[model samples]
Target: MRQQMLNNGQQRIGKGLQLSFVLLISGALIVSSCAKIEPVVINEPAYLRVFNNLRFKVTVDNQDQTHSTLVMLINPEYDSNGIPAGAEIIGDFLVTRNSYAPPYPSHIGNSLDVYNPEYPGKERVNAGPILNGFDLSSWAQVPSGQHRVAFYSRPRSEVPFFNLEMRYRTEPIVDTVLDLRAGEVYTLHVLQKDFNTKENGILLRQENFHKLALADSLVYVNFYNMSAKGFFEAPHTVKPNSGNHLLGGLNLEYDWFQEGIREEMNVFYVAYDERFLRQHYDGTIKPLASFMTHLKRDTENPATAPYWSLPLFFNAQDSIRSFLFQEFFFSRPGFDATPESFMIPNDGPEGPGAGGYARLLCYGNGREEPPAPRRQNYVAVPNLIVTTHSGEHNPRSFATVNSIEIVNNSVYLTTVQRVYEPPVY
Candidate 1:
């Protein structure tokens, strides 16, 4: 797919910090300084499909070079026509002879120019500009259905822009009837598996956190794009019997530099243990009905972090819960405060810190189940958090960390939340 807006000044704060992070791990940060993007066009355009074997006649679209386009599938989300929605096309074959030169200044362009000591031009591969290879694949587990694929060039400026054409498969859906009853709780274990990275590794911001539905209570789910990096990469290793460890990453430091770093990060998901939730509340999860979000520190770069949600509202009447979860009178228009806070506490003295769950305001579409007091389902909307912190190496450098909070509300489903099935994947 074509690139969305990539020029955000908000990200500049982190570029320096990222460079510093690289420097600390490698003793020095490297830069190709002199890389050129050359486009290549194959005899046939690269073709991708839903669930089938494909041999794309890849082409490098550039000037004066027969650059090989490396294609890797990404974000495998299929459209109504069963084609990939988006993928990353990086240009690693280009090189710049000079880092500090006129015309080619040091700017973070779509074509990333990283320096590698072992390359022919001492220029490691970076995405974009010209000949960077493109990753074209289906999103993890392309839904078994018919969907359209969106094909387009990205970043706006390639030596010459290319067009995308898609191929798809059509099928039928069969329904099976199973005698199932409502009210009785069903135990479901959702395992989110994906690949990690050598740079900023990926972590499961959420695991099979607990979700309980009493008979016919409603449940709403929301999903959001947290980061552009590591969203679709996977096939990482996990420790024995560790369910929470779906999110993982590679050590860019060790991978880029020659470090003895051989171990990978294994993050475990905190399951919605009936015993734990029961221990925290009563044995029943419906009683503690609520929405929640918390922050988790990134082990690789403590400055970077992830936020999580805890059940916030529960088996209460909608009218009352709605009012309770409503935005605090003092909340900013954009909700730029503590995410997922509430104005009042469940049961406390009325006033300052005495009243509601500070900042626990619920907005957007909700599910319809049994009445409030009998409500069984709890949904979390989607939202995002962007944090800017001081860099570890260059005090002048700063890092901007963005996290996606797919509460049952707005971030993703926030705008689409409604009274029906929980909005989860």
Candidate 2:
């Protein structure tokens, strides 16, 4: 009985924090007759999603990378009665692994016994906060204008976000006000920009999941290079990947002598084919599909980084003898621009092994699930998709991965799910 009362108290406190956070940020938006100060009003709603790509003290490829889970506090000290108190906890112990959290109605709460007998294996049995890579998290809504939010490093322990000890010890990593637009979906990415200075910044990008008219076999994919300023130019031997460990460079001496690497990155892939084929770096086997794009120059470099999405043509249709996984690579220019032979010398792991080629994200769309011990359905690759916004990585019929976020040596994914039962607005 006492535990239940404690739970109810926490709920009440959370509600009060949400209410006050908005009011304080909005500041009444009072309207004046002579000097009109437009009041901020949220008619519909603006959606938001966040990613924690902020590399911290963890050493990766000889450099520090982000390995900390965070807790987000809104109005750390505010209440409805104008009293300063414990802050509201929105995101707790949020990590890089992708989990699902959409805006939901308050009454429809998440439950452990909320299972359908018709679908036995579908629901997680003892799922707590995170299940099936999806959590009962919701997008905390706010007026689409400007709002203050702070992210702090929290311990993976019994201490809750509301505890005074935790709050006092945790320091803010990201503290700023965000300017948002109404009726627009936004994704906020906190990235570690520099290693020496230990500075981090957020990259806010508009997310669009609007249905695109495409065939069932096609999936949309766009690549955004969010690596540090000198990602390509840096001498990296090994970097952190999604797996227990996923990064190992082939060659990283480009920076040793100021060698100008190739501008375009070679992308090589083979779809789910029944031909029983394999790709080799010795130029024997050819990739089923291949494309090339220019790499984003380090912010420190004189070259300008392109800020547009590339719609790569990918077919994820499953077929007979179809392998449940796909492998792809990004390498510097080769003899003829082909992935196998026309590649940088010793780019892959095998023959002579180097770093230029060990950078690729491997996720497949197969009919049957692959072997167990998978990373949210993605296999180990050179550079694994460290985090994802959605778990629908391997869409059965093949769907577009609309938003693909890439960091220095990590990757995050969000796919356009095919509507089985469309939602009625």
Candidate 2 has its poorest 10 consecutive residues by lDDT at 116-125
Q: Clash number for model 2? A: 12
For residue 159, model 1's alpha carbon misses the true position, in angstroms, by 12
lDDT of 2 by residue, 47-90 (tens): 55566765433553523222366665555675574332455325
TM-scores of all models? Answer: 0.21, 0.55
Best candidate (score: lDDT) = 2
RMSD to the hidden true structure, all candidates: 24.2, 14.7
Residue 158 lDDT (model 2) = 40
